[model samples]
Target: MIIAFWVSLFIILYTFIGYGFVLFLLIKIKRLFYTPASFDANLEFPSVTILVAAYNEEDIVDAKVENTLRLDYPQEKKQIIFVTDGSTDSTTEKLNRFNDVLVLHEDSRAGKMAAIKRAMPFVEGEILIFTDANTFLNDEAIKELVKHYRNHKVGAVAGEKRIFVDQTADASSAGEGFYWKYESLLKKWDYELYSNVGAAGELFSIRTRLYENVESDTIIDDHMIAMRIAEKRYIIAYEPKAYAMETASANTAEELKRKIRIAAGGIQSIFRLKKLQIPLIIRYLHFNTSVIVC
Candidate 1:
């Protein structure tokens, strides 16, 4: 019983804190021996398609469009596509007003993965970027994400997600904000060490040609999409400079629900992404057990 208690205590501490320390130390040692490759400054930017999936988000559809338009990418090389599969609101109407943006909508209420699948055929860019309809991206987001594509091994690039919490924020909001801040740090180390386990939906990009169609019922489409590419032995690079900003959940209850959903998705993804799971023996042999999920 004493040995079991000690083992359980170690697991809990390692899950919450010890792993971060180990990761930091591993990264420090790695940096001493490894140097990142440099890219040519004269290389031209590749054509990019910024895909946004919106469902009944009329309030922020226009703002999202404006934000996308404001991104610092070559106008001629960038394509903006918004997919509203089941939006009954003015989301489709508002998006229609943007002559520079392409709007795809269907009355049937298919899930987000379904909407993305429908938008796949229309993607005309060498690089495909995915962002949430409600989050606002920094102007350099597209530029930062696409730059990593110059490295042939980088199959996907994940941008940071920032939560905005003002002074009046409740415990949930502040906690959420702090959580992401730590997550951002872990993702940085994860990329530097090898590759991130998964990418968040707030903002992430992949090579158009490498895109694989996931199941329509995918619970965490973004995570699945990125991990599938990772399973191909390609790197999913993380860029802290290119971030998506959004408000925290409305309340503690909502925050809890969001976390629970994510936890469930993580379990689902682990079973589906069998290739990413290293056997206990292998991990023990390598002394590497830290897995960073974004």
Candidate 2:
């Protein structure tokens, strides 16, 4: 009994301290190297397609389109697509105001991944960016994401997601804020040490050729997108400066729903991507920290 008790205590201690130590070592190693987020002049810049899936996002659809259209790239080199599958609101109407945006809408309430699948064939850009309608990207997001492709080995890039907290919000907001900060750190180091395990749902970009159609019922399309690319022996990098910003979930319950779905997706991804697990040491290590920290 004593041996078992001591073992359990040791395991708990090791989990708490050991995870921090591993993250610290990784951060140290990352600071040990330097990387530049720019491409050589000789490398031809590729076209990009920004794809957004919206559901009842009328409140922010206009802002989303404005932010997307303002991305730094040649207008001719960018294709904007907004897909609204389940929205009964003005989301489709607001998106239609922009002639450059190709809006795809269906009255049927298919899931988010289904919406993205419908937009796939319409994407003409060499690169495809999947973003949430509620989140807005920085002006240089496209440029930063594309620069990673300068290295042929990089198949996907996940941008940092920032949650703007309202001080009046409750403890869940604080928790969510803290969680993403830790996540941002993990992704930064993962990309530095090897490749990011998963992309933030707010904004992630991938090579069009490398883009694969995820399962129609995918719970977390952004993560599945990155993991799928990682399975192809390609790296999913993190560009912190290229960012997407969104508000915390409407409240704690809504946020919990979001969290539960993500947790479920994480479990599902293990089976969907069993073949890739042996190669993703960073994901294994990073996940250890997350389950503990959360």
Candidate 3:
């Protein structure tokens, strides 16, 4: 029992705290020998499609549309598509008013993954960027993501997710905000050492050519999409400069529900993606350790 207790304690501490320290030390050593690669800004930007998925998001769809239209990318080089599958609100009607934006919807509610799949045929851009309708992105987010594509080895780019919290925020808001800060750090380290395990749904982009149809039953679409690209031996680059801003859950209950769903989906994804799992036993240890602690 003593041995088991010690073992469990070590696992928890190492996964939650020690790993970050170890990762930081390793990154410093790596920087001594490795100069990060850069892409030339002079190269022409590829066409990109900004795909936003919404379900009963009438309240925020207009703001999201405005935020998207305000992006810094050249108008001619980018296309916007909104998928509102099963949105019972004024989301579809509001989206239709955008002359340049394409809207895809069906009366019956299918899952977000299903909505993305249904909208795929209409995507003509060389790159596909996925974002949630409730989130707002920086004006240069797309531009920052596009620059990474200059490197042929980069198959996808994961943008940072920032949660807004303040003094009046509840426990969920504070906790989630703190968690994302740590997660962002981990993603940076992952980018330097290996590839990000998955991408956050708030904002992530992939090469259109590398895009594969995600399972309609998928619970975590962003992670699955990023992992699929990683399976092909392409790196999922992380760009902290490009980020999406979103509000925290109303309270702990809402946050708990969200976490539970994600946890279930994550477990489901692990099994589905087992065939494409990273082969190194050491990598597996690190992956599961971090997951459990999180």
Candidate 4:
């Protein structure tokens, strides 16, 4: 009983706090003998396609389109696509109002991954960015994400997800914001140590050629897509400067529901990705941290 108790306590502590401290120490030690690579501003940028999947998000479609247009990437090299499969709202209509954006809509309500797969054939850019319809990205997001691909080994780059919480926010909102802040820090450390375990759907870009078709029913397609690339011995870089910002859930119940779904997905991913043969420490960290967070 004592042994079990001690082991359980160790896991809980390691999952929440000890891992971050360990990562910090490991990074400090690594920096002593290793020089991190720097991004070259003069390198020619590749063509990029920003793909957003929307479902009945008519109210925020216009804002998202405007935000995408305001991004700093070269207009000639950038392509914007909004997939509104199964949307019964004006999301498709509003997206159509933007001449610069391509709107793909179908009467069927396929899942998010299905929608992404449907839009894959039309992706003309060398880099494919997946983001939510409601989240807004920073102006330099595309530039920051694509710069890492200059490294041939980098298969994908994950942007940070920031939650907007005001002073009047409730406990759930504040907690969600704090959680993402901590998550962003962990991702930074993870990349420094080696590579990020997975990417968030809010804002992440991948080499179009490296993208494999994820299962159509994937609950968390972003994580799976990134992990599949990692399984191919490619690096998943994390860039904090490129971020997606969105509001917290409306209430505690909604937050709980979201987390529950994520937790379920994490469990499913564990079983599906059991073939991943990365370093044991990284695998452990990824699994435990995901379970704890959800």
Candidate 5:
């Protein structure tokens, strides 16, 4: 009876207080995210390289290219590179027509990390932004992300990832939407309180100097790369204005598979980066909550 009572009490304490701690941090963060800065539109835009990983993304490749070319930043200041791995379809074929975009195609599908590794040598920029072929960024995303580099202390910047809600919605869509909404809220606060624990590849930037090639089989390479930089004490800022839009994962079961894969990878990531997972030491409630969803 005593043990059972203690267990119930413990669950209650964690459910209420633990969640409250996250909320408290988020409240403090909202003030930070909204704080204005002296960022200038006329400021010199440094050269940037945007890397997109495409694996069988033929249907969306054209849209991705068109959107990247339309980024509000000056063309002379940035480059877009599409890395296609094991794209046994029209993805490579579609990329061939774009002279402005550099396309790297490999026959073997070694996964996203491998494609990124092959493309890293070709990147000629002070900063590199990693994005997915499935997501589309705001026109001002590059401009908004680059302005924070004026501080120099900021090593990486994450953007808001919005899931476009449509009329033919389903539970998977709702689940995915709810996940990112909760995620975006947490990210807004996480960066405000301190640095965001990691950056989502949907839209995130990092200094070229800090760029390190992760393992070929890396399940959550984005988190590993971003957090590795964070462990070095560099600030990973979050900008809500710089957003990326994408649809739900076709359906909930697909989203579930994605979530499960992420959760499994997250378990590996935590063990590898365990030194940084000390509760309250590093902002991980949102991250752990994400893991639980899978």
Candidate 6:
């Protein structure tokens, strides 16, 4: 019983705090001998497909469209697509009005993962960016994400997710925002040491060819997609400058619901990606870290 008690306590502490501390030290030590590759601004930017999945998002659709259209990237090289697979509102209609945006909608209501899969075949860009409809991107987001792809070793790039909190917010908002801030720190260190565990759904980009079709019922498509690339021995680069700004969940109840779904998806992904736990030391270490937080 005493031994078990000590084990449990150790795991609790390590999982919550020690892991981050160790990762921080490891990253600092790694930088002593390692230098990240540089990007060539003169290189021709690759084509990008900004894919958005929306369901009953009529209220924010117009703003989202405007925000995406005004992004700081070459318009000629970007293909904007909004998939409203399960929407029964004016979302499809609103999106259709934008001639430059491709709207894919169907009366049937499938999950977000299914919606993304349905639109995958139509993507014509070398880089595929996945983002939530409600979140707004910084102007330099696409540029930052695509620039990392210049490194052949990088298969995916995860943009930071920033939560806006004001004085009017409650404890839930503060806590959630603080949590993402901590997550961003860990991601930065993870990138320095190795690669980010997974990509946040708010904003992440992947190489078109590296995208593997996940299960239609997958709950966390973004995490699964980015991790899949990591499994292929490719790095998921983290870019702090490229961010998706979003508000915290409406309340504690909503925040709890979101976390539960993510936890469930993490468990599901752990089982599905067991093969990534090969005997390789570095691979096993990274996979272990992913399981704890992803």
Per-residue C-alpha lDDT of model 6 across residues 115-234, encoded as one tens digit per residue: 888998999999999999999999989999999988899999999999987566668898888778877888888887665675899999999999998988888889889888888989
* Candidate 2 stretches greater than 4 Å from native: 1-17, 26-44, 285-293
**Per-model TM-score versus the true fold:** 0.92, 0.88, 0.94, 0.95, 0.88, 0.92
lDDT of all the models against the reference? 0.84, 0.81, 0.85, 0.87, 0.80, 0.85
Model 2: how large is the Cα RMSD against the reference? 2.8
In model 3, where is the ten-residue run with the lowest total lDDT?
280-289
Residue-level lDDT of model 1, residues 68-89, one tens digit each, is 9999989999999999988888
Q: How many backbone clashes does candidate 6 have?
A: 0
RMSD values, in order shown: 3.3, 2.8, 1.9, 1.7, 3.1, 2.7
Maximum-lDDT candidate: 4
Q: RMSD of model 1, in Å?
A: 3.3
Error of 4 at 61 (Å): 0.4
Q: Which ten residues in a row have the lowest lDDT in candidate 1?
A: 285-294
State which candidate has the highest TM-score: 4
Native-to-model Cα distance after best TM-score fit, residue 94 in candidate 4, in Å: 1.1
List model 4 lDDT by residue over 1-294, tens digit each.
Answer: 999999877877777788788888999999999998898798899999999999999888888899999999899999999989889877888888889998899999879999999999999999999999989999999999999998899999999999997566578898888888887998998898765775889999999999899888888899899988888888999999999999988678888888887777777777777677445455555554554454
lDDT of 5 by residue, 28-73 (tens): 6676667745787777888999999999988989999999999988
Comparing 1 with 2 on lDDT, the higher-scoring candidate is 1
Query: Which pairs clash in the backbone of model 1?
Result: none
Is candidate 3 or 4 superior in lDDT? 4
lDDT by residue (200-238, candidate 3, tens digit) is: 999999999999987888888998888888888898999
